[model samples]
Target: MSVIRTAILGYGRSGSTLHAGPIEKNKSFHVTAVCDVDATARQKAVARFGCRPYDDYRRMLKEEPLDLVVIVTRSDQHCQMTCDCLAGGVNVLVTKPWAVNAGEAQRMVSTAKSSGKLLLPWLPARWGSDLQRLRQLVVEEQAIGTVFLVRRVEGSFATRNDWQTERRYGGGYLLNWGPHIVDPPIQLLGSPVKSVYGRLKQTINPGDVEDLFMGILTLANGILVQVEYTVSTESPPTWFLQGTRGTIVVHGTQLKMNARTPAQPSDPTQYSTMQAVPDKMLEEKLAGSLYGDEHQIYKEIAAALCGETRYPVTPASALELSRVLDAIRTSSNENRVVMM
Candidate 1:
């Protein structure tokens, strides 16, 4: 398709702001229709994008001749809606935490395969410049030597009383920000996870679910990754990486690094006299902004649809992330480490 005809299945915050905005900005895509349960939202979509709007997704699927459907609905509805779109002979791009669990994610993947349609998870963070720089420094350049520990902390003193705080709706920190936070460290580690230990706590959020969560992942190479999020306190560093020969701390748009090359003393008794040393101290700017460029993902998607290139986030990789999510939730609920 020269210009992919796209329809948005949800016209809420994520649908309008995150999905529709970038898609409309891309030259390879055109917003043809929108579906939302709310009549007001449907009207808003029609006015904003000058497109046909429907109150039901099934009706939109049946009526619109769309080449792609962007499913931006609630977490629990992602799997079925994706399957419906794929079965309707349209490619699908669903929002993060694509499904409630691994089983649902697998079902969506299977349906897409059976229908011979493209399935993509909305993981735009994979294209972030900060992550690109991290990969270049940590993996490609080995600037930090052998990475032994990685920590990602994201949170602030705040509270949410929305539907997101409700567990019945697949609402919690694990499914909320977890996909974005969890995938990066794992991707940087470049190794299969051996085990996961997780913990969940309800601090300030007015819901039955947790607002604070932590996950400790042990990778196959013995690298340890720790991710902690909360709504009750001030946030620490966005990223901290500790390696055998150096340490990196992400301070806003720059990386502050301290590194040294160790030279063993000729005498065994000189161990205590070793100088407190970091031979090098450096500050490097990130490759680009940590956020923005939602359109890049849409461009890639359009190219993938046209058979020009491969999509970075594949169905198989998404399925693996779903399984990792399952393990984290199970570990938290059972209060024990879950081995992968």
Candidate 2:
């Protein structure tokens, strides 16, 4: 197949670093055009990639015979930009969180279906080394017997003044870091969520949006997944998983796990009189650096565009995440658990 001509809308950190870097390295894709509202960013794109740059994405879409358009703009712009690209007969790869709200997410999915173009969300954590290792230990190897809980925490002390801390731009821990932390647990559990409980607050940030958030999702299989993010704390373990017979902890790129053999049944008559003893535990640890580009979601975009494989981050999954996100917001506002 011919190289897929691609256009990226947005020249922010995510646009320049996450999308552009990978697309340039992959032979399957060619960065033919880029559009940004900022003139400086547009000029830089032209100088860096030698691609056509436009100040407006609508004009770029109209002029370029692009096969795929990657939307890495502000969170609020995701839905509308995706709709326009799909309507213009170009496939779309939207950076997560895919939309500002569930309603917008639904519309984007519908547009993609009606237009017969692929709508893929960029969820890099789904392929992250740390997450991948945890999945192998718990899901594949069953090193952690009968996993019961998964916890992910991301915390840092900072005062931000950028658009990231603004409500109008969909700036908040829930929308900003929610998708990255939430998607992996859903993939690991492999079950439908039954209920959601959440708490959202603005701590040290000077913006109107939330700087701290916690969400508890109970899956249909009874596994509880807790996702938390804060701008108040200095450090926290990035991941924690608990199972009936083992536990796993991760900090940055380092991972440590403890596993034990499940207790075997003793005499039924002694159940009331005998005291159970814990089994001998086994421990393992690893510290390694992540090859960031290996987790890039654009490779999947190229494969999907080439008809080589189905895109793993499907539109249905994106919609499910959006629904959960909306439910979390509602739960926080109403101070009650929301049933899914």
Taking every candidate in turn, the Cα RMSD to the unseen true structure, in Å, is: 1.5, 2.5
List the pairs of residues colliding in candidate 2. none
- Candidate 2 residue-wise lDDT at 211: 85
Q: How much is the lDDT of residue 286 in candidate 2?
A: 45
Q: Each model's TM-score? A: 0.96, 0.92
Clashes of 2: 0
lDDT of 2 by residue, 1-340 (tens): 5999989899888899877888878888888899998999988888888999988889998999999998999999999999999999999999988898989999998999999999988777777777677778888988878989899888888777988888899888789888877777887778988999998999898889888888999999999999888674567778899988778888877777777665555765556533334543544454333323433466777778989889887889889988888888999999999999
Model 1 lDDT tens row, 78-142:
99999999999999999998998999999999999999999989877677676787888789988
Which ranges of candidate 2 are over 4 A from the true structure?
Answer: 232-234, 262-296
Residue 110 in candidate 2 has what lDDT? Answer: 94
* Weakest ten-residue segment in model 2 by summed lDDT: 286-295
What overall lDDT goes with each candidate model?
A: 0.86, 0.84
